[model samples]
Structures are given as structure tokens and as C-alpha cells.
Target: KDPKACTILLRGASKEILAEVERNLQDAMQVCRNVLLDPYLLPGGGAVEMEVSHRLTERSRAMTGVEQWPYRAVAQALEVVPRTLIQNCGASAIRVLTSLRAKHTQEGNSSWGVNGET
Candidate 1:
């Protein structure tokens, strides 16, 4: 049995162009090596913010004192992640966020999010 791969030939206008492409490919490979070696990945794409906001909101509701206000404020601020994502996608932030919130509540899935393309 043979492990196999195909060669990719990059044609460029000049030696410098090829050199630059090679340098970028090497840089990307180095990053892959680092990831493989360390294997530490941070949560991204607004998931962490959304989860934090949800948890804080729940915790705030359970509180019966002034401390709840601060937690509520932080939760509301955490919402900016999804709101900004929708806004940047050229969608109506209020409408999308309202829909997203409804979906999350109804489906009971914290991962529910707006489709930026739609």
C-alpha cells in the first residue's frame, strides 16, 4: 500500500511572484504545524459570546438583588456580537436579532443563529 499525493504546479509571471507564493505556503504550513503541536483552539464565531450572554441572563433572573443589574448589563452587552454580525451582513439588526432570539427560545438551542446570507 502506498500513501499518495499529487503535485500542484503554480505558474507565475516572475521569480519574485513564485517566491512570494512559496513563502505564503510555508507560513500556512508553519501555522498548521503549530496547531498540531499545541492543539489549543479558542472558541470563535461569536459562539462564546452568545453562550456567556445566555448564561448571565439566566443567572441574573435567579438573583434577587442589585447584583442582577450588573449581570443583565453584561449579558446585553454580549449581545453585540450577533447584532454586529447581522448588521455587517447588511441585514436589519433588530429584525434579525428578534428572529434569532425567538428561534433560540423556541428551539431551546443556544447555537441557533441568523443566516447571514439570508
Candidate 2:
């Protein structure tokens, strides 16, 4: 019974909800522990995926006829992440994805992510 330690009592209207809350809390604690063990974070909301897609698309442009298709295909596949993010936010996926791609193409702009709050 350490007074300084974090503690909380959660109440749910149903057993299922309480179990879900417990699971979520446990997951959050695990994430905190992992963060303490190794402090690092990947770009959220498809930023890294978009960056990879941009690089692959750029690389495809430099290759010969047949060799470029695979790079292009993979680049297109990776775009699904950001596109889904935009669609979930009730925005035009095509327009936002085009903008996101353009942003990632610029200098020192690899961290640009899809705006999920829209």
C-alpha cells in the first residue's frame, strides 16, 4: 500500500465493459513500461509509411522499364495507410493523399502525416 504509487478504481455498467477497461489499462501500462525500457517513437498517422512510399516512387523513376514496376507497385500499396486515415476523417482521400505525397516529396519534410482530426 504505497501512498505515492498510482492507483485508480474503474466502474463499468457491465462486466464486459469492465473487462475491456482492465485490458486497456493493462495495455497502457505495458506500453509505458516498454517506453521506459527504450525511449523511441515512430511517426504516427501514416507519416513513415508515406515517406517510404515517396522514396520508393522516387527510386522507381530512376530505374529501367521492367525494374521500375515493382517499386511503383509497392509504393502504391503503402499509400493505403494514409488514404485510409484521410477517409476515416471524412475528407476526400484522393485530394488529401495527393497533398500528403507532395509534402513528403519536399526537402526536410519526411515527418508530414495525414491530419486525422479533420
Candidate 3:
């Protein structure tokens, strides 16, 4: 009904480029539609993983014995998500991980994450 509200008109030099643009536009449009239907969007990046890892790690300390090991292992594994994100961004994994860990542990800020731009 609203002609100019949400429309895509792509023009390209070659068929291949046009096709690629059309495909990408379709994919983006689908994402927009899905978001509109289900507005509950999870936090992007590794924030969720870090939060889960932090909670798991804290709970692991309460366990009596060997049961704690699994929780600790899973928590450590969850941390790999953000660590890999940092390394993929051409940053020092060790430095970023250390900083993140300190922020979460010492400062009690579980949401702290490495800025990819750095």
C-alpha cells in the first residue's frame, strides 16, 4: 500500500552482480520480516556466552566434587567464543581475554567485551 515505504530497486552492470544483489536483498528482507514477527532478539556478539560462562563458573564452585569439573569445563569453553572473536579481529587474545576476565571478576561487570575496532 505504501509505495515508497520499504522497497528495493537494485541496478547493476552485469547479470551476476544483479543476481547477487537481488539474493542479498532477499536475505536481508527475510531477516527484517523475521525480526518483525519475532521481536525477541538475543544480544549479538559473545555477550550471552560470557554471561552464561560467568554464571556456570560461579555455580561450579558450589558443587561438591567431580560434578564441578564439568560445569567449569563448559564455562571455560564458553569463554572461547569471545576469545576467538578478539583474535579474529587482529587483536591480542591474551590481552583481551585477561582484560575481560578482570572486568568480569574484579569489577563484577559480566557484560564487558572486547571492542573489535581495537
Candidate 4:
């Protein structure tokens, strides 16, 4: 195909991918809202934050199908939540990324670590 045609194809594909991501994010947000509103879900403030962070990570992973991007998305989302929530949770948004990175490194799947061979 022509170069212009290839570019257009790639753009279209990327748009589709992003649209799917948005849909998944919406579904995840709804689930998170439900869990947060449920009195039985998380009894304590710390538990609530931890659960939210964990859910965000899990949802991001489940939606993205890739390790890195999903983790990034989770971190970004967490950053947008209220600071009080993060403070009370005893975990920051970056902590989620760090944990994921550490897990990947331990599993020999990370490329940014010291060895740089995995």
C-alpha cells in the first residue's frame, strides 16, 4: 500500500485500540464505585484505599492485556483520586507501579533492572 494509506491504517488501528481502552476503563470505574459504596466491601479507611489501589491495578491489567501500559494507567488513575485517600491508604500511586515492576523483575520479565537482560 502507499505510505499515506499505511499511515491511515495505523491511525485507525490505534483509535480502535484507544476506544476499547476507554470502554474498559468505564466498566472498571463503575465496578470501583460500587465496591467503594458498599459498606461491607472495605470497613476501614486503609482497607478502602488498599482495595481501591489493588482493584485499579487488577482492572488495568485485565483490560490492557500488557504489563507496562496497564500499570501506567493504574498509576495515572490513582494520581487523580483525592490525596486524602492516598494518604490514608498508606500507599501512593507510584507504589503500585513499583510493586508491579518488582514483580516483573523477580519473574525475569523486566528490562529496566540492573541486569537489563530480562
Candidate 5:
């Protein structure tokens, strides 16, 4: 047998659109390639960041005074990941992030992230 070749056609109204779409497709393909090379999957939509933030916040509780502040600060800082994601999508960052934070307070919901699709 020979080999199989696959083709992908990108259609857009303008060259700029075509180029942008091509770049996006290339990025997606790169992610696929990377996952194939390294067989591990990470959640998208800032899930990991939210989880880290939740863990940091929880760990901060054990600290006394100054040490606790840093952990809380970093935890708040980590929220910026999903907050920025929401802002970029033209959504309400405060509202969505607050809701996500509330959800993360519950056990087993540490991975909750802002849904940009909403």
C-alpha cells in the first residue's frame, strides 16, 4: 500500500480571515500533536488556574499572619486567569468569577472555571 493524505480547506471572506483561521487551525493541530507526543491532558478554560487558586486559599488557612497574606494574594491573583478569559469574551468578569469562586468553595468543585461560551 502507499500512504493516505488528508486535506483541509479553509474558506473565508477575506485573506486576513483566511490567514487568521489558518493560524487557529495550525494552533489546534499543534495542541493535538503535543498531546500525542506527551500523553497527558490538561483542562482548558482556566480550570487548572482555578484549582490552584482554590488550593492556595485552603492552604492559607494554616498560616499565621504575614504568610497567610501572600497565599491569599496569590490565590486572588490566580483568579485573574479566568477573569481575563471572561473579560476577553465580552462577558461579565466580576459576576462570572464570583460565581466560579462560590462554586469552587464546595468540595470536588475546584476545577470549576468561567464558561466563555456562555
Candidate 6:
């Protein structure tokens, strides 16, 4: 669960690949904002609620797309994207999602706990 380790490993990865990943992520973010926040897409409260659900689903899809390219590029670069990156990304993502959930729970908005608590 050491983020520094992940950072160092990523640093060793080609800067070109890393830059591509960053660009992809930025594009995904833009798509998310466009689809989720467009006033014309949801002009009412119930519409907004449904749009939020749709947006969340699409966000997952977007993230998958963003990760896919870098994953393939990394695999090509190293002949295999290290299992470490795969595991570390999964772990780090879970940690981040759980932390956000905890924040929401503390605010009396949700209640969920992740495994791997230490």
C-alpha cells in the first residue's frame, strides 16, 4: 500500500507512456463533465437524479477506456505491464474509494466499509 513505491515504478515506466495516460485521463474527465453537467441533458430534479446514475455508470466506462490504452502501452513497453502496477492500482483505487465513502458515511450520508483494514 505504499504509494511511493507505485510512483517510483511508474517513474521507471516510459515518460511518453505516462504522458499518454495523463492525457487520456484528462480527456475522460472532460467527457465526464460534458455528459454529466450539460444543462440540456437534465433540466428537472428527477431528470438530474437519473442523469447522475447514468453519469456514474459512464464514468466507470470512461475510466476503463482511459486505463486500457496505458495498460496496453505499458505491456508493449515492458513485454508485460508489471503485476505490481495492476495490484497497486487496484489497491490504491480501493483505498481512495473507501476513503471517500467513509467521508460520506461520517456525514450521515452513507455506510459502507472496505476490507483490508489494518
For candidate 4, write residues 13-108 as lDDT tens digits: 587897787777779979987878984532322333334555566556666446557665665565344344444556554664455444443433
Residue ranges of candidate 5 with Cα displaced over 4 Å: 1-44
| C-alpha local distance difference test of each model | 0.77, 0.90, 0.82, 0.49, 0.85, 0.43
Q: Which 10 residues in a row give candidate 1 its minimum summed lDDT?
A: 100-109
Across 1-118, the per-residue lDDT of candidate 2 in tens digits comes to: 7586877799999999999999999999999999999999666689999999999999999999999999999999999998888899999998888888889989988988887787
Q: Residue-wise lDDT of candidate 1 within 33-72, one digit each (tens)?
A: 8999999865434555677777888899999889899999
lDDT of 5 by residue, 2-88 (tens): 768778989999999999999999999999989899988546588888888988999999889888999999899988889899998
Best by TM-score: 2
How many residue pairs clash (N, CA or C atoms closer than 3 angstroms) in each of the candidate models, in the order given?
Answer: 0, 0, 0, 0, 0, 0
**What is the alpha-carbon lDDT for the whole of candidate 6?**
0.43
> For residue 10, what is the lDDT in candidate 6?
29
Candidate 2 overall lDDT versus native: 0.90
**Quick one: RMSD of model 3?**
5.3
Look at candidate 4 and tell me the lDDT of residue 95: 61
- Model 4 lowest lDDT segment of ten: 109-118
Q: Which candidate, 1 or 6, has the higher lDDT? A: 1
Report how far residue 31 has shifted in candidate 4, in Å.
0.6
Model 2 CA deviation exceeding 4 Å by range: 1-42
Query: Which pairs of residues clash in candidate 4, taking residues 3 or more apart in a chain or in different chains?
Result: none
lDDT per residue, candidate 6, 1-118, as tens digits? 6464433222327889888877777798798888878834323212222233333444455566566565444323431222233344455644544353334334333322222332
Q: What's the CA error at residue 68 for candidate 2, in Å?
A: 0.4
RMSD of each: 5.1, 4.9, 5.3, 21.0, 5.0, 19.8
